[model samples]
Target chain A: MRRLPVYLVLDVSGSMQGEPIEAVRQGVQLLISTLRKDPYALETAALSVILFDAKARQAVPLTELMAFQAPKIEAGSTTSLGAALELTKTCIEREVQKTTADAKGDWKPLVFIMTDGHPTDDWRRGLDVFRQAKTGLVIACGAGPDADTTVLKTITEAVVSLDTADSSTIGAFFKWVSASISTSSKKVDLTKADSSEINELPPPPPQINLVT
Target chain B: MTDQDSAQNALPRPVERAWTQLLEALRQAGVPSAEEGAYGFGGLPPEVRRVLTFIDRRWPGAYAASDSATKIEETDMPPAPADPPIVATEQPAVDAAEVTPDAAEGMSMAVSKQTILLKNARIDQPYQETIALEGVDELELIDDADTGLALDPEQDAAILKGLPRHSGDFLLRLRGWRADRPCEISAHLAVIPDPKSLWVSKESDREDPFWKPDAVFQRVEGELLCIGASKRGRAHAKDGLFRDDHVGVSVDAASGWHIAAVADGAGSARFSRRGSQIAVDSVIEHLPARLQTHVSPHLDALVAAYLSQAPDAEARLKGQLYRALAAAAFDAAKAIEAEAAAHDQTAAAFSTTLVVGVARKLEDGWFFAAFSVGDGGAAVFDLDAESLTTLSLPDSGEFAGQTRFLHKSEFVDYEAVAKRIFFAVRPSFTAMILMTDGITDAKFPTETLFAQHAQWFAFWRDDLAQAVEFSRANADLQAQLLAWLDFWSPGNHDDRTLAVLVP
Candidate 1:
């Protein structure tokens, strides 16, 4: 089956400690549970979780949606968005199969990076690598007022700003993500035209707006 | 009825006349036919039209046709390179390309004007052949049906195109003319089977349910006792999927040949579970006959030379055995490929790793040969020595969790494959165990663990031996082995397969 690999890069730093972290955790769980109900996502969506703080680690490797479990969110010292970006690239290279001349590989990955704070490390290098990726649709979300929308824009054209990191807003963002994933996963077909690229995502809720 | 008769017969009552008048009014209002104007873009408001136009321009396939058309023009119109005209061959056209000196050198075959003959060419490695064509213009290399490339005349002899990876009849049809007579020649090419290409998922119009039985076990008794079981991993079980590993055992009492095979289907491959099943079943079906025909004649001398430690004798024996085993593996790969083709799918959709072992009972001991294509563990537990000897070691790639699969197209190097074939003539070995990476990753994570953990094999030998002795039938023993295979570690979960042989 053609798989739509989805990676979630989340900021689990000191700033996102109590409520924000809890919201992220709950939101991710909700996203996974909702995706499980979608037959399309269950068959075609492979999910991975990357957590960035002082360092980045693949908390969950790319796994089919049926087998995927949301990783526990732990707040670390500082946001290492650069490390997270690098790790995501590595994960894509290793896990996602790129189309070749002889055989078709996996579909282009769908990546969502949610951050509530600016990177403490040099993130430009990671951004450059990500930009050079042959196949992926990256969406960066700035969670709350403290997030640097300017930096998020540099990372991806599809940037959204969440007004608050409250549970309701975070939950809405996740619900939108689940819906977008379900749409993309259902659209993918090996025999038809390429449906890997997401053209129109589900509109964000009132608390979330395009960071134009 | 004709249109005029139907129209004349429809003389309207008052309601019918009103309906006809309404239909005429709607037609006069410029209602477009569904086929001609389904979207009714003209009827949309100006603002909506402008927004739609903008969005349509950004749509994925909007520019695909134009872009591809331009690409086709560029590729198809390249000027033919200048080259001297070839002299026509009047000698009643030789049936096939003449074998060049390259054929004697190695796996290379050079053919001119005639069909290219490829015999036992390695499937795991890429092969290139020199085709000597005379008086041909505009040679087109057609790969399958959809893709074709024009060959450069100036560099005709030096051209090296990669051969097809799967085993089947491939055609290289030369459509250019010879002596301006419109002569066409087709080369019937054959690729020796390798493991099926890795399986990738395809979208279906209907829902394709992905589920299979979790585990399977089989036992066959003859000169040697063979017990094997394959179990689904915890991760797969949680996902409601079957085990991607399969095992098969075949024993020929008359020939004293005990054959056992195990295959691990690639987890990422969509239909690898089927691939693994096909591979194991094929090997068990084919290996015994292959050994008797190819290796039996030289077995006695080879074993005698091996026992005496004769120079080159062991190497010779190993080579012969390797070729036989490789041929068997290729047959298994071909079977899987054929199955995929029958299902209108590519061979890669059934990619798997294969390991097969053949052992013959001797007067005092057993003579065994084992071959493997990917990462798995095989060992002999010597009862007399109380030591475990590693046979076929796990071959890993550059990174962790990376290993070559039998289905990889680049796996055609038989010499490399030969090196991995393990052969031994031991006086007394209590048991032989072959396992997939699922068990090895948890129990023997590294080469060191494989060496240090003699107890692991000992546990299996003792438990299995007792089970075999106590159990009334093979089913009971199979159940015991299946339960034992469920041993789990904290994080490592993968499909497990184990085949054990006792003499």
Candidate 2:
């Protein structure tokens, strides 16, 4: 009767405007559709998305995937993966620390960050703060030709390089992502128990991107 | 086991009463979990489960990476940051003439029916794929057999990793053999070899490393077993008989767990033989102590710890080892990274693959966890997956048998991407089998060999006379799984090893 939590720390920086951000939106919906089909993921996984530009915006909070609604994709000025990073750090720290929440804190939640450009803010500082709280998996994906993605790679040890922003891959990549999640969830259940004694939470989602 | 089930149903009354009293007490003290079913049952059983979940929920940064085999429990993590070089690689233009609907549409269609055994896509089509979940949330989906991370054609080392989809080899589609059956299976699979030229030692007329019929596998009772089968493959004069490569472990009957591990050093690297010895010695030497030091003492954790830290998780694995090994494998990986550096060589300098296993015999039934890494593969015959098939762990999307980032590095950041992935794999399961790449390619889909319970039960109680006799007599089966370095592995004289343990 426990649930799995998933958060999206999306990069809505300046460079994501043209086709990149739109592809991300479509992918998000595809992810939801994929989860709805899996008996395990639907019952266990929850979704939340935060969009960051010069500042961070919460597209959605920690809502069940079944009840999730697609938020509007709004592009803004400057690439601030650092600010988005910091916002993500706070939101997750709060969610994990929330004692009043219904479900007992589940697996350290999975956080996926997608970005086109690099960080316009001081990345080192944000990274220092983020690394200190080791309760989650933070995977960053860099997209497009102009995005300065160098700084985002420093967030988590796992950084997936997405080659093109081609709208076609957006759906395929998400489907692949969903398939992997289903497989891991199945492996997790088979490997451990549902009683919560093993604490061997299934691995968080992988970071992926669209090649432009 | 049935009593345990009954115990699960009999909610704790006394503890529930105590919880009510405590909640009342906390009313004055300002605490919670006050009433309702939350307090409906509170006893050692429920409390134990509650405590475990609570600790995981409350502890920030306690969970380790999926790749690691341990948890980070209530420890102070040093301030470490990740910095993967974020240089932008120019996106190549898509060629319109070469467009295929599946490729352009991005939906992944099943290609190889041999998911049961190792198979490849078109040799010329660039067997690379990247697909996202159509609708899903968990991020664990990208590790599938088809997701290729390094499939670029121009890279130099990429070519060296292994042979590209062989032109003449038949392609097999991956099939799910255990959908409705038991989680365990016994299967027969062909051990594949690397098609590269360098996999073998040359000139003098001995067994060629690629073609050397070295690797082997078997099934006993309901259990799957692999051993140091091909001593003839290690016939080279340069390195002595690969006793380290020939290492093996066996599990006994008990609820407790057992483990075994073996590893091989890349022949091209200097001191690689020493590295191989160090890897094996580390597993044999440190396993007992690590088993005892770890709170639960799982068969899998012991092997994982030993493989990460040799002789000592304390003295040797200071930096890279810490990153490779979890800090909470009862001991921090950072504590021994220094020793790793001293013995370390570049990717080209020294490289070795690990073979490990974790096992347990529980009262409810029996449990075994085994896995392979790089090459040497481990087979698990469980009745769970299907009564008949033995499941082979799929390759980690290898270009061939070759892998990435095992090379020497200047920096030893505990959070390095390479270290986080190859090392520091969070302990997710209680039992496991780990092995070098050499053994994995040696297996072909052979479920018929291990699926019959009646046959397996006899094999379990049967003596070695029957078991060894069958294996030695089956020359056709044996040749199908020889070490590829002899037959074709990138080239042999490649070190091969395996370990199995049950507790």
Candidate 3:
């Protein structure tokens, strides 16, 4: 079976403390619940979480929807988007199953990056590293006004912005992500194709805005 | 070359300039940097390593004197940026000798702030952190009911033992004496439910507005021994959703015709269960009735002519068979459309794929006619001839995961509907199988495989024969067939409907 690997790159910077961080945790829970209900996503989608603050670490490895445990995320110090991007690349290389001669591999991974602040590290170098890897869709979401869409633009062409990182907005973003994963899972198998553009995904909710 | 090579070649010049400026600034404020530079920047981040590699490759180790600090030849180096090799410090060095357990006060261990554990999984130690002391006093977990963790007080954060029964976020508070100072700290841990345990089988409510049975099974024993079962997928069972697949099998004693139909409802459709039910029902109800009415009177003459290789008679029989099968399918689609319209819904809301096969024994051979719309398959397997005749053409739509469904427009053209109606005469067919996408996608994943004789044979031998006992006409055959439909296929957990006919 060819699984659809989904990578969620989240920012747990100091500015994202309290309600924002709590909202992120709830958003993850909401995403899981929504995806579990979708038969397509439940069948093919595997999820992984990479959290970045002072440094980046994989809170959860690539796990199938049934087994995935929503990790307890905490807000830390700086926004090391560079480290997060670099770690995402490394995780994708390590965890995603590759197509061998005898067997089908996983679908190209879909990466959803949500950050609330500007990069506090050398993110361009990380972007350079990320660009080398093969991925399906790389959607970078700027969660709050402080999030730098310009920096996100350098990372991926599919960028979205939210006015605030509140629970409802974050919840809506995760809902859209669940729908995207469901759509991607169904499409990839139905058409034997991968999605790389934002338009391929369902339109974002009112709380989210696409950053062209 | 590769994309990485070009990417590295295109590494911006400003990064190098920034690196050179930073080194120059560090040198101006340095205090004997070369002695501490023996590690060769090995533990630095990739960004730092990339810059170092870039500078070294361009300048031939001019800045990488740190690689061999002992063998420094000052005369062999350029003089413009004259400076001793320097170490890029990742962090300020901590003096180990000055820091004793007794001296260090109010410092937290490197324990994770938020730890995640799997429910019912035993962990000797969830984390590797340990607090070192004289072995007299150790950190103790203040056993909380919320936390399903049991810690050994003798060892400081060394072992966390227990099978966590519940799954949720929990707070773990710790109390211990570090450096003889009573210290208290709290950490958060989340235990997740096991995936296998999360698979709950909930019965779909009969009182629900759009209720359908969790499974349906039927069997007929006669000249054509037929058995079919349609079961709700595990995904649907977990969510208490209806079984969106339907199967119908009928044996006409007078006409000697065995008809079997399998219809799969579109997963995205709101009322597809009814659509599938209507599709399979109409095929069984109308096709046999149409055949009996239109072809029964001329059956003997048609068979005699076909046995004598009469081209005109064969064409007439084929035309009648096509008309009967097409009319059944057309009726199924129209009925679904009518239902949708009555409910003020679009026909898409009741989308379904239909595959129906009618088989009968004749003088020449066993005659089979089929009509299909959507992705499932219908095939006649002949063991003696070692041949398989596929009766249905899969209709894959332009979009991903999209398949053409039985709709009013599907049967608009007579030529098109005639094309969908396929007929074959096999000398002695072992079985005819009509299956929904659930079975086809799992057993024969690709079109190439679906078309292969070897694939059908293997499916009969390995998958079907292993799971079902067709020779036994016993009462439990229905259960056996239903059990066979429950074969595990990862990522292929759609509602499965399989109808088999054996002459």
Candidate 4:
């Protein structure tokens, strides 16, 4: 079976403590609940979560939508976005299937990175490692005014900036994420083609502005 | 009550009657431990006292020790307890206060028996629910962001103004007011999935460089009934993609020869649809003529050599049929290569899987021969013989999801091409079936299941027979087969092509 693997790299730093972190929690919940209703996403799309604060860890591995359980997220210390990216690449290497002489592998994995503050560590090294891995669309979301779109643009061409990290705005971002996943899954299943760029995704919501 | 009633009888009638009424009201109001002293009697809340007063007026002398207690006339009662509108009904069964143990003094605000406002509401459908609450003057429904529902106080219901975006169990939190007291109650609303949302048909662009119909069906009734259909899968149709599968069939009554070709275009190839089209067409154009000129005159000799079990004669007959099918497959592979060259595209871009079956009636039975490339299957089902003869070997890899396609390399060696050809003889058979991976993977699922007779029997009897009415003739049979191609299998959406030759 050709599975559509999705990786969610979140920054659970100290700056995201109050409403922003709570909204992020709801945002993840919203994404799961929304995708569960879509038959195409439910059948093909698998989700994995990577969280970074003082340290980075895989909160949830690649799991089918039906059996997936949303993990409890909390705000910790530093913004270890670099560690999260490295961990995401490592997880992809361990989890995603590759095409070989014996069998055809899964569709290219989609990576979504969300951060409220600039990375506290050296993200360049992690970016270099991530670039070497084969992936589909890597969309970076910068939450609130503190989030830097210029820094996110270096990571991927598909970057979206959120006006605020409040519940409603973060909620809209997750909703757009669900729509984008649905579109990508439908695209590969129908055309047998991978979605590599941002134009293939649905238009982002008002709260989320696409960064060129 | 037997001991308590007698003990209570020892007290003075007026004090006992007053005390009994107070105690009964306190218990009904759920106020624990009210003493007989002045401070205890004065300690009762105003609402509880009002309820006791109302109860005394409504059911006079009911809780009194003596009949004379009815002298506390209605004139002394405060004008009428009208604020809460707790209409303690004559029938206890329908009383709202009796229904809820926590009625909060005189407030009888209780949710009605309809605890579930909505059951299995479908996504993107309009829904409206009116809740019944007793002793409630005004009701307010909390807005649930996910459900997309709003409170319509004028309509006195929770109206799903727009289509519901999500499907799940939603709790509708409602707050109703009985005078100053606020009562909160929740009702369950369940939303079911709408399967049709999973499939959306977009119109294919005819202006594209490589364009084909979304679906195709063909039927030819001669010595044999040949019905074949190819349909764009849900996945392809959703994005307005071309049908990457094709079927070509020919049945000649004069020559007593019938041939059916089914091909599946590689999904990754840009022009594989054209490749599949050229493949099936090349076989229909070349194979039937070759069988007519070469095999027709030797029919009697071949049948005699087979029945007599003469090795030399039988090998000669087998060689003729094998060469015919193989040559046809080779021609198909060559034509695809030429077309790819003309379009300035790689031959691999025109990759496809092809399965062809040729049948000729003889004195003993029907002689069936087939040549195959790639993963689809071709088989002859013989009900009388209680056997299923698989005519072609699948070119699937060691694991699933990989299949070999028709290419020049596959047919370059004469011996290799001959290995792909198989022959069988059956006096009477049910049907000759040729299908692409779309149909085979969904119906057969596993190789073990595909190789079993019982699976094939169940597939034919329970699935195919129930779906298509083979007894129907001509156009009707073609329509049924084309419609039957729309059968759903989870994680198995692909371009489907099927050919069935029934005697």
Candidate 5:
């Protein structure tokens, strides 16, 4: 069976210390718990969590939803989006099973990058390298007013911005992420044409807006 | 000039070496070489394209033009040469196909002997087919005798090994009676070309592999009683799948022995449900007989020597009992291996953890012996002391989620596993419980929790005891154990199997 690999690239910089970090943790737990209940997501979805601060770390490797554990995200120093993207690329290359002549591997991975602020490092180089490799749908969400939408736009066309970083807004964003994942898990079939891309997604709540 | 010589003449040495390296990398990444076939260069990275363009400028026709083709056309093209058709002869009962020299060589080198399972056909039913070859000697059917089809030789061996690259098709005539009744059997032959492939057919999805059937209560009026229940996990239920855990119970009234066994199939294995079923069944069916043959006859002398505190006699007794249990576990592993062999699969496909135990009603109380080959919990509930004693502690590998399977080499290695077998002669115990990791993981997530969770076993015993008494007073207990086993725990959902023996 082809697995639907999902990567959650989260920012755990010093800015997201209090309620925002707690909300992200709760949101991730909610996403996993909700996905575990859905049959399609349980069987097909494989999740990995990546956190970026001064450096990037893969908190959890790609694992089946059945065995997935929500990692504890601690607040760290500067936000290094470049290191995060580089880590995501490395993780995908090492973990995602590529389709071969003899057998099918995993489905194209869905990547969601959530951050509250701009890059402290050179993110353009990482974005260029990532774009060079074949990847699935990448949705970058710029959280709070401090986040740079222009920088995110360079990484992916599907970029969104969150007006605030409150618990309610974060909760709403995570709910949308879960719903989108559930939809993709059901629809994505490697054998079919035009099934790789996320054609339709649940509209984000009022607090979140499309970058365009 | 030759194509190799022309290419050498057309490009500089360094550029040619770089191009060759680039092509090699692409091939390693499952992309066909440009010279071998049309390939899409448009989707490739700019660096790769620049190298390819340089090579193209020097040697025209060396690579496909980037602008000429689309990505879909390049990636989705069928194999260059189509597979050959099976040529059938005039004979109705037997089909004959001639093997081309190239096909024969390919078969000899690339293809290993495989067991092709004919769907909807019993082991007794015979299917006939023939393949004509041109080079070398006779063809043979090397398969297990239990498969029932009459072949030239019954002894199992590798049929494909050491055969000269022959051009003639070997005639295979299968003859056997239908196991059930005389009827026309139509079936499709399914062959698994690669042993590591976990590809389960769509037909297999019809029945959830992890679905556990409802518990069947057998009310036995004796000092010892046995009840076993298996339940599909919440994860499996959400996924519309069957339970991968299986349990079996057997009572030898004459021998005063009640045996319970549980097998938890590896979650990742494609056909582990079947493996767990076979493991449990083999243990229940084979263990009692083995105990009777190997341990029963010498029990008196061994017990007397053991009471006297003789080191040699105690070692002998322990060795004999361990050997008996080990043999039974080995039989279970062998059964799974045999099943995999029959289906042309690897033993890993049927990986499962095994726990089996026998409880005898002694003059003093109960004599218990159990063997566990993986990660699971087995405990004895001491009624008199109102305490729980773990019989076989879970054997976890170095990693947290990793555990040994019965079919794994380490489990089959008797010398390494013999000491792990558990035995006890308690004066009195209310019940004995055997369970898969699913239950223990939920109820007792940590070793500390397991040590502190005597209430968990007490809960089951009290509930089951009441149910048993109620059944005695009214009607039989209607599968309440299954519902009890379905208790939910977050993020720890897996197939739950529990077997309890109570007096």
Candidate 6:
């Protein structure tokens, strides 16, 4: 039950057009591919992908890693994370139901949110839902030049800002994520473990890094 | 902190002053803001009045909880996640005018005394569905257009009037079992001779994770049965050893004429996880009544019968749903095991053990049949026995020690599946348990785990009878059973699995 499922909320707005979008796509691909190869990950994990710009869409439902497929990122006009947030809550609500109370109800579920700009749609309710869930963990990442770090901070306890919004930094974050997942997957009940591994994760903007 | 003072002082502000106030209020309440000019809250009780006042100031003319807007200086409104204070001029918050229970009120509705009742039973959704009374006003079935998963409509977007901070997702209360559990049917169980692979996968390997069972399966709710797997593993992963074995309930939901099949991976097969996954998924997806009627109750014939279907189902799965998008999620999982082998990774993620249960609801009663391969065994509690007993089927060799793999193409025949199967004789008053080897070692010392849980649950149903409670009891059995592999099992460890069938 310690096997946690992750939800990735990615912003595919027009501002992330050329390389930014490509890096994101590559970043996701790298993370999943890395997870698939991990021993603990193969045994204790699953993934769900949600993409949004003007509207929100589910590229993949909650599924064990073997069945997960990285979706192609298509940049569009608006950045509507509100829809993505709403949908993410719904997805977790339903996915978690699939698990019984006796098992890993304590299994840690972490949400990795990556965005470039502020929500184009009303996102107030989405934040409320985030606060209400309290069941899972949320990590927000602000990318490129336009990302509003302030907005990202509002939604999560852990926030990260990236420079250039390129693959190197994105890939670095993913490698760290892969490590975290591998660590998290080792136990069905993650009680006491090394916090340094988790804390060492990419810090929020201004303090973000490109090297290991 | 006084509402009157905050409002009077708040009076001297720019036209967009309310926005700053909203953010300030949120921050004061430990609510972070998205922007500096974002909304803030002044001095309001965590109640509805304060939130309504804030909404009025932002939209000025839009949002209305009762009928229209009012500028009251009372701080009694609770905070909520709803439409942005500003109306959706160019950007609206999720279908804005949708009349969301004002932020301050929605939470209260989620947990209010207003009970949600599942309406009358129908064929498609025979199970009674929950209907929220005054608490929830509307429901939306937002299905992810992709994946084909139908989202629950009852909880989607609701409006609650006076929400309390204690509120969260609406507390769902299921009604009595209106219709029969989905895919109600009978099937004959076909467990190949053991002493072969299941009970003794270690004879095959010592360090591999695939050689042992890590999960258990149960049909707790809806048409889709549930599966939970775990192992204690390395010292660092000791917590992994704590699996939730509901003390054996999947084996107890038996009656006359119905068959429930559960399987565990050998932990040795690179694709054992898939083995168990495909075994369970295939049985649920395939295993028609006709097939159930074909297998004989006797274990030896069942093994012969189970073996014949192995190759066919595996090959067929590749072209059919069991392999493609519909590929049994478990089967796909098994493939990952194979991939691990190809790479010679330390995970040792290959072979898996298996256990299966087949149950049917008949005119007489619920009939159940089961099969256990690898290290695990099967048990049943007959009212006549007074306690749970092993349904000792045909084991090819010693029950005292580990064994070898029997069927050559087991992947195909897992679901009692074969062009030709021998139907089993119906048993009366039965409780059965099918499990992996780790269970036999130190976990299920009582050995009578099947009867123990059956009796305990029977006491529960006869005593404090709550269906959900009963379900939890069963899930716990699975968790505990799987945990044994993670903890007590020696060596690097192996897979552990157990399935219970009751009649």
Instruction: Give the winner by TM-score.
Output: 3
lDDT digits (tens) for residues B385-484 of candidate 2: 3232222233333332233212233224444422332212222221233444433322221223233444433433352122333243455433343432
Candidate 6 regions exceeding 4 Å error are A1-3, A98-106, A189-212, B1-452, B455-503
User: What does candidate 5's lDDT look like per residue over B1-503, in tens digits?
Assistant: 48655743454433334444555666776676555446666655434544444334335644333423422332333221131011110110011112334433432343222223232121122433332222212233322222333322322321222211221112232211121111121212211111111122121144553444533333443456677777666555545565688888888776666888888888768788888989998988888788888777776677667667777875676687777787888888999999999989999988988888888765555677788888777877675676766767657776435688887475545567766676666678777888888777655555654654366555555554544442333343435555566564433457778788777
lDDT on C-alpha atoms for all candidate structures: 0.67, 0.41, 0.75, 0.75, 0.65, 0.45
Model 2, A33-137: lDDT tens digits are: 566555456545667788888888777887765456556777788766666667767777776433222222354566777777767887787777777553444
Task: Summarize candidate 3's per-residue lDDT along B1-503 as a digit string, tens digits.
Answer: 46534543442343333444445543554423445763344433333443454345444544445445523244433222121111121111111112233323212242223232433231232423343334223445554455555555455344655566665456666544333233455644545444344457889879976787888888876688888889997667777889999999999988888989999888779899989998888888888789987766777687677778897976787678766887888899998988888999998999999999888887667888788998898999887789999988866677545788999898777777777777777779888999998888788877777888889999998879767877644667777888888787766667889999986
Q: What is each candidate's DockQ, to 2 decimals? A: 0.01, 0.03, 0.12, 0.13, 0.01, 0.02
- For residues B224-243, what per-residue lDDT tens digits would candidate 6 score against the true structure? 13333434234222323322
Higher-lDDT candidate of 5 and 6: 5
Considering the two chains of model 5, state its CAPRI-style docking category: incorrect
Residue B42 of model 3, lDDT score:
40
Alpha carbon lDDT at B49, candidate 5: 47
lDDT of 4 by residue, A74-164 (tens): 9999988878888889999999999753345788999999999889888888888888888889999999999978889999999999988
Interface RMSD of each: 20.3, 20.9, 5.3, 6.8, 19.5, 15.6
Give the per-residue lDDT of model 1 (tens digit) for A1-212. 45789999999999999888999988887787677655556666899999999999999999876556567688988989988998898889899976543334677889999999999998998887766565467888899989999999888878998999888888888888889887666444211123333355666778879877
Sort the candidates on lDDT, descending order.
Answer: 4, 3, 1, 5, 6, 2
Say which prediction, candidate 4 or candidate 5, comes out ahead on DockQ. 4
Sorted by TM-score, highest first, which candidate order results? 3, 4, 1, 5, 6, 2
Candidate 6, chain A: TM-score? 0.85
Superior candidate under DockQ, 1 versus 6: 6
Superposed Cα deviation of residue A25, candidate 3 (Å)? 7.3
Q: All candidates' TM-scores? A: 0.50, 0.30, 0.65, 0.61, 0.47, 0.34
Q: After superposition, how far is residue B36 of candidate 5 from its true place, in Å?
A: 99
